[model samples]
Target: MSLLELRAVSHGYRQGGLFAPRTAKSVLRDASLQIAPGECVALLGPTGSGKSTLGRLALGLERPWAGDVRFDGAPLHDRRGRIAPVTRRAIQAVFQDPHGATSPRLTCLEVLAEPLRAGSTGKAALRDQATALLRDVGLDPALLDRLAHRLSGGQLQRLCIARALAPAPRLVLLDEAVNSLDLETQALVLGLLRELRRRRGIAYLFVTHDLRLVKGFADRCYVMQDGQPIEVADPFGPGLVPPAMAALRAAILPALPGPRPLRQPAAANAVLP
Candidate 1:
């Protein structure tokens, strides 16, 4: 069974204010995708292609105007129209902006500990668990007391990753999670995510505009256009490319700089100043 699945789901937002007549602004139309257990699936498309909306639907953050979202062959929400506590913990999200994901007023220790409060009651045990989570994400436990604003970009991103993992989620919705970081930081965070997936057997829905980001990381790649996913065979391999894939591939800047020719030395016998 698929760990997460969206079946012909359509979603939209309301437009126009009161007195102006409200209308539905459709963002997704019969869009569908799936993520299997421990699989890394990439949702690749340009901005406003409804990739993030699809992710939100999968995470139960938004209800689809049409179709259904299923987890392990069951409806994602209960009869009361709410995700069960256990189900909510089974899924988590880490968005692009780390700072926005957390509050500047809260300390790192508190941010990480909040999720664990359900099981851990004692203060010392919670602190220990938070410290271990920090270390697991390659952060220093000593920085736990610092406010969110005090951490660097890379540090803040990793801390957010740690917070997402606090519940030991089965699937993580990573929506452009590394797109804002520098190249070096992006590589480091990707490596950390790969390691964590290996150690914990977590599935990821990596949503991004850069197809290059999915080259080695994703088991399967889906190109989104017109709010629907078109599966491509061997994204970087030799074959016919879908129009959406071609467009996205063309948008990716060269990952590495080309080699420059060495300057020739002046003739030794030519002249002396």
Candidate 2:
């Protein structure tokens, strides 16, 4: 069975002023996809293309107006009208903004330990586990004493990833989690994520706007436009084979200078739009 599956899922949002007639804007239209255990699938699209909405649907933060989302063959909707704790724990998310994800008042240790506290684990064990998780994410143990505000963006992102892993979740929903980091830090985190997937057999629903990164890292890719998925392709295929989605993607890439300079160019500027 697939680790996670979305069958004919559809969702929308109400727009216009609250007093005005609420116009329903459909974002996802009959979307269906699956991710197997240990698989890394990337959702690629431009901004406002509903990639994050899909992530939210997968995490049960938002429910689909139609169709179903299943985890290990169980429907994601609350059974008996209540979300099962076990089900909630199986899926975790790492958001794009690390600072927003981490509590400013909480130290790194407390942030990581939050998951364990919710998991019925003892305090001592939680601290030990949190420390181990932070180490696994390539953060030094001493940082645990520092508050979220004291850490760099990359460090906080690592902590978010660590916290997601604290429950030892079966799947991780990463919504542009690497978009805010420097190239060096992004590369390191991507490599670490790959290693973690190999070691833990965890599945990933990686959402991002960077087609280049998706092509290199994802096993499969789904291209979305205007709140709908337009193409699905294997990442290992021949170059630029997403013919149907090529124009959309080509339009987004900035025009490069002819005969690009080499010798290890500096990283591209960070701009999330």
Top lDDT model: 1
Question: Over the full model, what C-alpha lDDT does candidate 2 score relative to the true structure?
Answer: 0.83
Summarize candidate 2's per-residue lDDT along 1-273 as a digit string, tens digits.
998999989999989896798799999998888899889998887788788888989998888999899989988876554557888898999999998887789998888877789867887887788889988899998888899779988888988999999888999998999998998999988999998888898899999887656755778878875556655655334466555356545664445235757776556985547
The residue-by-residue lDDT of candidate 1 on 1-273, one tens digit each, is 899989999898999997899999998888888889999999898888889889888889888999999987889988787998888999999999998999999999989988889775599999999999999999999999999779999999999999999998999999999999998999999999999999999999999998768977999899987779878878777688788888876667455356999988989787867
Model 2 alpha-carbon miss at residue 140, Å = 1.0
Give per-residue lDDT, candidate 1, residue 19: 81
Off by over 4 Å in 2: 79-81, 234-244, 251-273
lDDT of 2 at 194: 90
Q: List the residue pairs that clash in candidate 1.
A: none
- lDDT score of residue 154 within candidate 2: 82
Clashes by residue pair, model 2: none
lDDT of 1: 0.90
Superposed Cα RMSD, model 2 = 8.0
TM-score of 2: 0.87
Error of 1 at 150 (Å): 0.8
